[model samples]
Target chain A: MRVELDVPKCVASGQCVMAAPDVFDQRDDDGVAILLEERPGEELLDDVREAVAVCPAAAIRLVEG
Target chain B: MSDALACPVTGASGPLPEYPLPRAAECPLAPAPAAQELRSEKPITRVRIWNGSTPWLVTRHADQRALLPDPRVSDDDLDPGFPYVNAHRAAIAPVSPRLITNTDAPEHTRLRRTVNGPFVVKRIEKMREPVQKIVDDLIDEMLAGPNPVDLLTAFALPVPSLVIAQLLGVPYEDHDFFQRSSSLVLDGSVPADEARRVSGELAAYLDNLIIQKTADPDDDVLSEMAGRVQAGEMTHTEAVHMGVAMLIAGHETTATMISLGTLALLQHPDQLALLRETDDPKVVANAVDEVLRYLSIVQTGVRRVAKDDIEIGDVVIRKGDGIIFDLHAANWDPEVFPGAQRLDIARPARIHQAFGYGPHQCLGQNLARLELQVVYGTLYRRVPTLRLAAAIEDLEFDHTGTTYGVHGLPVAW
Candidate 1:
């Protein structure tokens, strides 16, 4: 599985970081999401999915194969 | 349809249950009974609001999630169909400056960007140590000062005021002034003139503070906004208003959560025990979200005007129609949260809409959550004997304010 973040659409609510800190982080300057792991391990999948689900701007996408 | 279901004002087919329906006295913690019923029976239905305008009240969690982010939905308060929370909001809409709260993208996206940097989860996490200090000091003061104190004034109210003041670089010495003025501004029952007066005072105060920060900037949110104003990224007034917005937005709502959240814990001894006994930060954090889900404190539903015709489920919301997304209703929706009425701290409840959803969701939510986590984690453990000094029935609840909270939480530890 892979993760994507549309930084333009990110509202900086930080729901993604709260859901999956290992998979996501926010920029210190403007809080736009930063994808830490483009392709996370299986153990982190559920948390990544939650990050995708809860991002207020709907900026995070989990591309599944 | 039966004549009984016909709305008198709109001649609509179903009864337009009034918007901002009163909560049942017996279940002070829950959303209005009628609103929950509407979630199940008529997820998207019209309801009359303060100005006699009939706006569609979207009650279901699924429906709110689907509709709030749609481009057809608008945050513009200037639209004729926009459902103002009350008369004061209606009166002030025309003169209000464009801010992150009232604009849509790309304007909202721009305005929000100028301020979002400091509030991100990482930025807020840095404050946990300081926030813990604030909580500890306040608890110490409470312990030293009096027994059975009014927790609302003693601890709950000061926590956010002090924190926000330090963050905004506003002098905590003026907290009493800002707190009082901000309270008047949020009170729905306050007359339009009085609300305007207090809001103006707050704006002017911040405007002056911004000018000072511009000269000798401090390490704070207001300073960052002031830098933006200098860089031509935003207007001077915009920076000032943003400060007021942060104070008004972050202050009372967080204070309410502290007070009402404590009240909720005291009411549910089992849940209180879990919170008190837990040494895990994750447990404390999850408990904070669960309590947020349980309370869903913001009573005035997120309001918007439909910019274009949009079809969802069976109803078609026409262009120029108004919509209200009842966060409490959606948070309590049984489809998403089974046994929605129960206040269980162990639930996986981060999905709640208490901070709302979409781009206009609460900007200070991460910070608010951090404050809550600190207080919920520390207070119970520090004062294991904490109990309500007053009967739940005897407590007064503020129904007219933007956020629902108790007037005074008398607590004895």
Candidate 2:
């Protein structure tokens, strides 16, 4: 699973960081989501999916490539 | 009073109950008992409101999630059928410019897009250090002065005004004027003409600021908006109104959360102790969301007008009908949240609709969250012995406003 985040569009509500901490960490300065592991194994998919669902700005997108 | 206020139930008593039902004076924190009763008896029940309109009052979480985002929902307040919060809102709807608050999708999408850049997580997060400084400085001043002070005035109100002033490149000193005007506009108890006068003053204030920014652009939201006006991307009036919306929206709600959230924490000592002990930003952040959910401060609920016929559960809402989603009922819903009434800080409260839901969800929410995270994470720890100076009953609560909050929260260490 390839996870992509549109940094510019991200409103940084921190849902992604809260939902999938290992997969997402907010940049300390701007608090925009920084993908920790863009391609994650199956174990983290549930959280990754939840992050995308909760992001207020619709900034996170998961690509199944 | 005709049969309009009568409950449709086959054998019931009293009026159908007012839409903005009075919260029990004793149970200041809980939603109106009538609202809670309606949530259980009929999740989608009709309730008469200020202007004698009977909008469907939705009370369940699942019901709100199903209905708020439905394409059939319309937020255009100008529509004669819109469920306005009060006469003041209804009176202005016809003259009010198209705004993020009143416009529905497509147009809402377009309008929201123009100003969405400034509030995105990245931009708001950048302000964290600055907001931290603001909170810390305020705490120092509060500590140095009187033992018992109204947190509402000293800490809660100013933090947002300063932050928003910084964001807008407006002077923080002028907050008193805008704050008064915004309060008058949002206060349902105020007469319509008075609210209109205040609204005009606010517009004129923003208009003058927009003009200033046009000549000497700064690294701020208003300056960015002025640039848009110059590029013909947005009109002068649109820019001015957006400035007013962001200022008013950001100020009162965040102020309310800080003051009232602290009050809630103080009431729940165990929860307060837990939050105070936790140094983890994650824990603190989650606790903020939980407080927002528990309070569900936007008491009037997210108002909308059904643009097309829609069916959810057993109820069918006809086109042009007004809908009011009672956020408190939905947030405390038992089906999604077990032991919902209990203020469990550890609960996963992120998806709560305190910010409302769907596209029109609060545009300034990210900023509000960060400000709260800083204040909540800091205040309790800084003043370990902090306690409310007055009994909960003694505190004056603003029941007639858009958000349910305390007029003042007197506290001492």
TM-score, cand. 2 vs. native: 0.85
lDDT of 2 at B12: 33
Question: What clash pairs does model 2 have?
Answer: A11-B120, A11-B121, A12-B121, B5-B16
lDDT of each: 0.85, 0.81
TM-score of each: 0.92, 0.85
- Steric clash pairs (candidate 1): none
RMSD of each: 5.1, 5.9
Top candidate when judged by TM-score against the true structure? 1
Report the C-alpha lDDT of model 2 over B1-413, residue by residue, as the tens digit: 11112222122313576778776665677767777677778889888888888889898887887777666888888877899888888888898778777887667766666777687566777899989998999899999999899988788887887788778877668867865676677656789899899889988988999899999998888888899999998999888878877877888789899988888788788899999999999899999999998888998888999988888888899998999998987887778777776778899887788888766777787788899999999999999999999987789898877888888899999
- Model 2, CA-based lDDT: 0.81
DockQ of 2: 0.21
